[model samples]
Target: MFSKFVIASLVGLGLGIGVGSVPVLQDHLHWNIWVFVPISGLVLGMLFGWVQFTCSSLLNLRVSTRIAFAFGLVSALAYLGTDLGQYLTLTVAVSEPTEVLSGQTPIRQLISFPEYLRLEYGSRFIKTGTFGNEDVGYQLGQVGTTVTIVVDFLACFLVAFATALVMDDTFPWCQACNRYQCKTTSTKILFADEDRLYDVLDKTTELLLEQSDHVKVNAYLDLVAAEQYLVKPGDATQILSVTNYACNQCDNKTMVGKVLVKTGKNFSEAKDLDFMLSGTS
Candidate 1:
């Protein structure tokens, strides 16, 4: 949906603007040109869009939170580092830099000559790189840099999008299966515990979750669903238990779950460690 795009783009814009405003990125890299912000925004928007699109896998809350944060962190860094990142990927131009910049070790200067540096539709940006300059730069010609930018942004967009659904309140629990699941699909009963959250939740989950789900227990006295979900990925080493279940309708999990117990090895420490979901009551 466009919401994802908008969120990612907005986040990208904020990050790109912030990172681009940094002294090192704008000044040291000499990306202070008018075209730089849009370019950076485009990259960030596409990068984040791609990361969140196809990569969204339903994961445990703790793991999903980390993954979401990872998405933002990578987006920020990537937006800040697109200049050097592209160059380091062996994208240097065939011709050497003709303009020798003084003052700062500018990567290269954008120059235009009537003959060799003619500005045409095909000609947008003249890639320049000095052999020994750490502070690299790009010079824009009157023709402007658009073709490479569109292509580059498209590339970033295509190679993007992956996330996990954690702390989801929209979904419901499977009453027949004795687990939290999506209303439309019983195939999603699998869950896992986030290793990092184990210590934190171990201390707090009991204290915080001991109360009844029906009781208005939140700080704001909101009537919250009293439920916990446990998922075991192929890599899980522990088990999870829950007391409440949402009203989401899904397939019966008994057959599939039995199959899991019968054939699956190296599973979580315990099977059905918690009470079974009450039948449709």
Candidate 2:
């Protein structure tokens, strides 16, 4: 768990820095095209969430809500830091001549950080025009800047929070083996009788679970001959998908079954028919 947190924090910080720097660079080149849309923040959050999920999966780390929230917070803070850093660099380091023989003057000498923030944010920073008319403008004052900051942070937080939770469900882990299960085989059967389909799936799962060796499990699976249940898609009312998973380092195995019912024009998974079984190989 500690390792997971450390890795997540590093990843969040790195990603935030990489993303935040792009806009600053663009601004320097006078080629900035960033539009502060809420949806853009959501998309960025999801991208961050995906990176976090991928890292956890690769490292075999279990992800929880707490870790996800921490990652979100770190990412948001790192991104905000870029903005503050840019402001400070401009105000404190960059100097402008006051007048002839006067001296170099830095913006820091005239305004503090808080005052600078209020003045800069209160000014019109973004403006867009259509063919010949002004179409959009953003002149968020101090109050609006505060609101925007909160909204942006929340957008990054909530989307990442939800994304991590959702992706975790798609992958199953073996607690006993302390690893992720690998899919060994999968078969899709078109069936007319739901009872027969269930019986075949149950029997297959039982036979595979009884074996102690992966080779034996594979041989038994072959004998089941799922192809015999295949039929034309147009003639089938339901489809049963059976997937087998096994832990490579141990004799643990799992079988997942899902049934899809054909509706008017599409097939939808039947939640009632979903089942999972786990046992020794």
Candidate 3:
């Protein structure tokens, strides 16, 4: 648990520094390093963690390093697959169009009229060669084809190589390697914070009681104290509860009031803590 907090803090700190130092990331996007570095780190860390756990279980690998390597390789392949899919879908939409306007093709074909005719009438157009009918759909670009098998082989090799380099040092118990644990601990902290809030309110009540006279203390003051003392993550309902009580009293007396403003601001701050605790963006 302590390690998770330390890891999250470090990730957040790194983000702050990276965002601040990187002129391109900051200048072009008009976003501070503090805004993106920790945010990006946390999100990336979670993504890596999830992939590690799922792949490890599926492959029955006990080593975190192996899982990270496998997932990183898969990420590379996914990137390649996405790129290839887009290329094929856009370049070879001839056969799959639902609104088949039979007159003319909307996209310019890669195989122009000359190439089409050459293949259509070539004398050696024997039916069993590399350019055979079985391969015709691919040759005509009727179906999308990925890069050559050689290129694909190289891609997989490179993916596996890169994965091994980057993730070979990871440990299963490391905070950087497991996001599920981070989320669980963060949730526990949030709930714990909520449970401890009543004590804070009680202390505030004791102080207010000391200051007030024999006359009834205005409920609004209690609400104000609640909002001001809400320094921790959990128990946001205290803010709403106190604010609602104050609002009800104010409404009956037709008094000028604004519990909502205080509550809204505190709510926004409280919301950030949840993400911070979760080690997620």
Candidate 4:
């Protein structure tokens, strides 16, 4: 577990540094750039969350709020690292020897890091409008900069946090084997009868439980049923989704069931229909 944490931290740090350098380099090259957008921060946070999830899945690391908090902190540090990289690059490119406050201390180094960060944050501005057209611009000052930093950091942190929570709640795990389970099979049944949704879901769940208990039994009947229902010509109002998961190292297996209601062209999960059943093969 400790080794997994160490690995995740190292990976996150490297990713942070690598990603944080892009904007700095872009700005240095005078490219058309905008880096302080909240959406950009959310996207970056999701990327970090994905990497963290991949690492955890590969390492069989347990997901928890503690782990999520650590990831959030690392992500924030990565954001700060981007600013630090920008500041250092700008200082090096623009500061001359005569710009030093003392004998050898550069003027940029004279102030504390936080003060420098505030100044940098205050210098950023947002512009909205079409390209090659009139645009409206808003620049941040002391208070606005502080608020923007807080809001941006919170937005990024919340995304990473929520991603971790979703993984913990939805991903199948084998408690006895102390590892994540793999999805072995998934089947969906479409039905148009809204009144019979629960009845069909219950029957399907019962069939799954029975099949799961007798691992030696052939699943041909279930597949035939799925095919029969899927090929029906009429539009489906609700879908009964079933998925099976298993642990390779043990006999532990899980069956998950959910109902999704068709909304226009997409299906959304129905509340109170999600369930999981575990048994030994």
Provide the overall lDDT of each model, using Cα atoms, as 2-decimal numbers. Answer: 0.37, 0.65, 0.33, 0.67
Per-candidate RMSD, Å? 15.3, 6.6, 20.6, 5.6
lDDT for position 20 in model 4: 49
Compared to the true structure, candidate 4 yields what TM-score? 0.74
Tell me the lDDT of candidate 4.
0.67
Alpha-carbon error at 118 in model 3, in Å?
A: 25
How do the residues 179-220 of candidate 1 rate in per-residue lDDT, one tens digit apiece? 445332222233343443344334333434453222222221
TM-score of each: 0.25, 0.62, 0.24, 0.74
- Give one digit per residue, the lDDT tens place, for model 4 in 117-187: 76666655656555566667766566766766776777667887777777766678889978888888887
Off by over 4 Å in 1: 1-9, 27-145, 161-281
How well is each residue in 69-163 modelled by candidate 3, as lDDT tens digits? 54445443333332233222333345544554323452224555445334322321112234544533213121211222223334433554344
- Of the pair 2 and 4, which is ahead by lDDT? 4
* Model 2: per-residue Cα lDDT over 1-281, one tens digit each: 68876786677666655664564452431112353455545766787777887777667777777777776776566555445554444523334454532353445566776886566546435566555665576665666566555666678778877778777765577898666777788877787666766776676566545643445544544554455445667877788776888878787887776889888878999988676767774
Report the CA-based lDDT of candidate 3 relative to the real structure.
0.33
Q: What is the TM-score (0 to 1) of candidate 1?
A: 0.25
Best by the TM-score measure: 4
The 10 consecutive residues of candidate 2 with the worst lDDT sum are 26-35
